[model samples]
Target: MFRFLITLTGLLGALGVGVAAWSSHGLPAFVPAEQLPLALERARAASLHHMLHTLALLGVALWCRQRPGLWLNLAGTLFTLGILGFAGGIYLLRIIAGINEGPLIYVVPLGGFCLMFGWLALIVAGWQDSGAPQKHD
Candidate 1:
């Protein structure tokens, strides 16, 4: 699980950078001129969240290596889910027209909530690990 999380973090980080580049260079070609600004804004926002949460996942992965607790695992899982739902949903909404009012609209906020809860889980992990003995190499 630790190795998987680390690999996933690296993959997500690369994907986030690629998405940011595409948003800046390629998005304008796809969106109409009138709608380009809003589309770009949304894309950039998604990329930002994508990159930030990927970093958070990296932290959780490293923490798991040291402690390997339930809360850390939950944090990593929630961070991954949040990135997918929040960032991936925004990218989908921007690229696919006429889906604004669909059920996908709920995904972004749900993802945001997942991110918030992931942080809370991290706090719990730290609290639980505080009294535990440290493992040394």
Candidate 2:
């Protein structure tokens, strides 16, 4: 279960990174002033990518056959909220506001920071599991 969750998260993260990279291929030609639409598109793509991570986090919490401990629970909470509040807020702002300045705009980056914390929590979970001594009867 542990391996599966970790591998799944890694794979999903890699896929998100890959799609972000691919989507960015044509971005260089645009001048800075004209990049608003492009940035919006990227943010939209990132939202979708973040959703994948969000789903993986849920799966890690719910689908794992073993019971989850504190770290997993915290990570899951952070990841879910971060994706929704951070990336979701940004996606909404871009779609609705048509630009960046607004109350909701700050939510986007805060979500990102939450996501970082979530990932860190996940690492800590793995580390804790690894540090536990194996027992045998």
RMSD of each: 2.0, 7.0
Compared with the true structure, the alpha-carbon lDDT of candidate 1 equals 0.86
Candidate 1 residue runs with Cα over 4 Å from true position: 131-137
lDDT of 1 by residue, 1-137 (tens): 78989999999999999889988999878888988888988987898899999999999988887778889989999999999888988887646453678677888888888999999999999888965545623
Q: Pick the candidate with the highest TM-score.
A: 1
Task: Write candidate 2's Cα lDDT for 2-117 as tens digits.
Answer: 55456556655665565455435533443264765766575656657485665758565553335556787678767767766665565456544445786757887888888889
lDDT of each: 0.86, 0.63
Supply the TM-score for candidate 1.
0.92
Model 1's number of clashes is 0
- Candidate 1 at 34: error in angstroms? 0.3
TM-score of each: 0.92, 0.59
Leading candidate by lDDT: 1
